[model samples]
Target chain A: MDKNYNIDEIENFLNQEMSAEDLSSFKERLAQEDGLQEEVDFHATIVEGIKQSAELDFRALVQDTRKAMLQEENTAAKVVDLNQNSKSRVRSLGSSRIVAIAASLALLLVAAWWVFLSPMSPERAFASNFTTPKDVLSAEVASRLEETGFANNQAALQQLQEAMLTYQNDNFEQAQQQLDAFQAQYPNNEFAAQAAYYEALSAINTSDYETAQVKLLDLVDTPNFALQSDAKWYLALNSLHIGNIELAKTLLDSLQSDSKHGTAAQGLLRRLR
Target chain B: METSTIVEQLRTGNQQAIRSLYQISFPECASFIKKNNGTNNDAEDCFQEALVVLYRKVSDSNFQLTSNIKTFLYGITRNLWLNELRKRSKSGLKLVMDEQSDREYILTADDQVEQKQEEEVKHKLIAQAIQRMQGNCKDVLINFYFKKMSLREIAAKMGFTEQYAKKRRYKCMESLKQKVRTEYATLGL
Candidate 1:
């Protein structure tokens, strides 16, 4: 596609350096000629690839800035810790005048640093408000396992139990595996829906937010899904985690009117706003 | 800062601009990818790709700010993450290598794999061609074309006369064209 236009023409067109007449003609050609439009699109895509790489380079610069800021904060925190520990050691030995003055100065410095540096970021708010929802199967489902036809779903329920236990034991990897197996075996059954919800939680625990979002979104659409409220809550948290503050706010707004999650949703909405 | 101002700052390579944009966009996109079994690094990569897409659109000569920047950014980020997920799934390539599978996974290179491999080769060749550019030629070309620097700005930055910068830029472009032709022919791209 790029072969159709010379580099200079491409550059001129991209930069809007072409004459007004030339620009008009070019736009007309782009509109009328499929081949020309395709060429431009192809060139644009390549340019986009290069630009994306360039943006990463720029992002690296920002990351360096953030890293430096964090390092400074850490160093300051360490100094405060060291000073506090020294103050304690000195107090245990003797309440010397010199140690007293040093401790006061150290405390003053720590206060000053805290005052200067502790502005709350949206990310911090998200981290503070977000809690992983529990993945336990319902007692009703567990009791129903003894009935006929429900016996057929017992293996899936057992798998769910194992998955929940593994999750509680912090064996998230195994929990994810068990959930996956349960879902596959019990597809189209209620156990599968439960497994999918747990699967999303397992994914979140593992920081696999994409898979978790997918599963959660699907669950939200399911008819009379038991975990729908929990799914919506976590989905909102997922939005917050990924820095979509507006989306998080919107979701929380919707949930503020929800009977079950309304209180938690209202609390989060205040923080977000 | 205003969105337009932030966009302008980004065009000029401002680190603070990137930081502001990152704070807004990274969390949601990162979470999306993470939920999809992507690592933080994978999320970072996808977010960067999405930013680039947005940057290109924003920096276009005829571009207009029709949508809210955040909405536009989120849309692109979602699409990019989804596309990346699809690609990873199709290829069965984990963004983060699975050590357990790594030991057992021997790639059975089919036509699709071969084609992908060849495309990668061609990409590298194109990159090499750009890399092989000499001195100010590379700098001038990158500044003018990629960085969208004006000839005068390039001249000032390169400490060369504007005429010399213009001439060198054309020469550098010609050299790139020649290199592309040669390399593509040699590599059968």
Candidate 2:
């Protein structure tokens, strides 16, 4: 950071108080500048932390109430069960009959579990939870594309579309080639993250899980990668493919609270557990 | 009763409202989890998490439920169970029919995992600091930030002048940031 770098400048950036020209310049600096960007990210973390704290408080309240209710209900149920058991014994429902009934109920529960509920392996869980994002051109991305620059940008967009289509069509090699070409042509393009993601996915499709994992890890480490979470998820899937259970669990656990992937991640985590 | 009333009651920490939620929602949710290889404990835990999610959403003044509360709750519970089912596939559990429609609820497929985790840790640290703070500081900070109240409104609510409220809010936030930074320094996060 420059000696004159004021921490309060981040507040201006965050609060949208910077002039338009300054804002654009700051963003350019943010993209290219290292330490300054880290500072901004650190400050943003505190703001986000404040919000999370409030939400956590609310969640804690709900959980506490639920816990208390469950505890009380359990105690009451235990008393009722005890009374019913003594009453049954007094009514001459012999110990043998009681034991037989208990054994039958246990068998019924086991049979029900085998018939209905069954555990899943982590690999199977991954397969079930992992789905291709239906279209990479999400509504947010589509609207932004309209406002983007032309010429090389337009060509890059076209190449990206082709790569995505080829991947969707299961042409892994062709998709990888198109993505490689796209990245080579526009190494620092705005959509570089998306291209890298598809490249990784293409690698996965071709059963080159190691290459896919590497590509996804690169994206995961890159600052301001637009698809960082998607990269993390694909990386987790890669871990599962390569039998790195601990790494996969770590990635999926981080994603469990994500708005988009929370359910999917939780599903995967449950299996791992 | 109207769903809005139930939501309001929940926000106020009404125990009866919580019971109502459980009574209406838990059975089907438990059944779904059980069929997907989850035990009663798993079902209860999943349902509670779903309720927490719902509570967060409903408590947000900006949120509007497009579906009936029951439908939305069921949707959340079902999504949670399906995810659990996926993880437990080692038990040879198969996807049931209802999962096909769960796709509609996915808002986006992108994430900010590392950054989110960073924030999550800081949140725990910050929450601890807030808990240690005097009640007045906590109230002022919560009102100004979480409740999105203006300084004047906060002042009026707490029976103080706007200037005092503003100063106190700043002081409280600064104290919180200092605590967080100290912990970060110590823990090297």
Candidate 3:
């Protein structure tokens, strides 16, 4: 701002390029001299001008990259599409661990999500195709069912209890119709919840263990409705039976923590050990 | 990492390298692009071209280091932006400036020569001011002002009362101002 002021020194001082003593001396000089003020204002203006010129245009980059990727994909399509036929004949299965288990089980390779993966509902799976672990009931409970002869309504509940009993006897497919009727009638009940497990076992028998495992988890962990501890063990056992070592180990470990299931599950874990 | 690493990786067509370089450059570039009446689109093109130029120059290996990476990037970006302005003008896409709105821009060589010194000083002052803040004050200010976090998000994430966060931010800003004024009094507006 001062025509006669040395712009360089004031620029250095104001921008703090000046050393401490020099900055102090410059500040003293500024307090006494109006020339330094003008020079600093001028220098700051120059810095602002240069700073204002700096910018980047990334949208243009993305547009260019997209064009390049599209071209690359076009070239790649000819090569990649040729191999599509072979994939149908033999699932590439990729590098995931789930594929390792599925391959051992000869699971249905189609992309249709016949298997649910969420851990929340494991029972609807079991009652659909497999045996419910009647072994989980205490002796008194088992005797009570035998005495009652499972003859409540003799309709949905009776059929469900019968199917559950037959499943306990390992008559998995024989229990299917009864379980289905029971599931439909008492959808919210524990018996209906266990229907999914039988469905799962049926799928597994057909080598569709992927779908079965999902249902097994629900049946195994029914909370205090009389099946939680049993469900976890069964889920773990099936996970192992199907060669899902990781899941099997996790469930088995959890079962080991519950004193009731711990004795039996620990035995299984020891065998695994 | 060094900007040259970005230059090298970009030359090899690494998309992540391209991403990182652009992300790091975004704040500085945004302010500059906004000032020039250029949309974010223009800034991106200029940035890519700057990256391309740097990538091309990186093979020399003997390129003298004259300035901090940000300053070097700023310089290159400045050059490319000026070129973009010229090209856009020729195509008549540029707006003609009104005499009153066209603020006089003056450049002095003195600042350019001493930019590194200025940066070192400013950076230290900023660090000092940031350090002067309390944990909660710093957290609010850094998240809201520097990191551009939303107020609602900051409150939820930090589990702070929203009113308390607001108070902290104001007090923090005032503290920063006081600190900057105390330590570097001659930072003329």
Choose the strongest candidate by lDDT: 2
Q: Mind giving the per-residue lDDT tens digits that candidate 3 earns over B75-125?
A: 677766755675566542322222232222233223243575675565555
Better of 2 and 3 by lDDT: 2
Q: DockQ of all candidates, in order?
A: 0.09, 0.16, 0.03
Q: Highest DockQ: which candidate?
A: 2
- Which candidate would rank higher by lDDT, 1 or 2? 2
- After superposition, which runs of candidate 3 have C-alpha atoms over 4 Å from their true positions? A1-154, A194-208, A267-273, B1-189
Error of 2 at A132 (Å): 63
Q: Summarize candidate 1's per-residue lDDT along A1-273 as a digit string, tens digits.
A: 334465566656876899999899888877897677655544444443334444445555555534433333343354356556865896789777987899899879856655555444566765776666554574555676767786667776776777778877777778888888877777877668878887888877887655566676667667789778777787778656644455556566657768988987876665555
Off by over 4 Å in 2: A1-22, A25-36, A75-273, B84-103, B107-119, B150-153
* Winner of 1 and 3 under DockQ: 1
TM-score of chain B of 3: 0.41
What TM-score results for chain B when candidate 1 is compared with the true chain B? Answer: 0.66
The TM-score that candidate 2 achieves is: 0.48
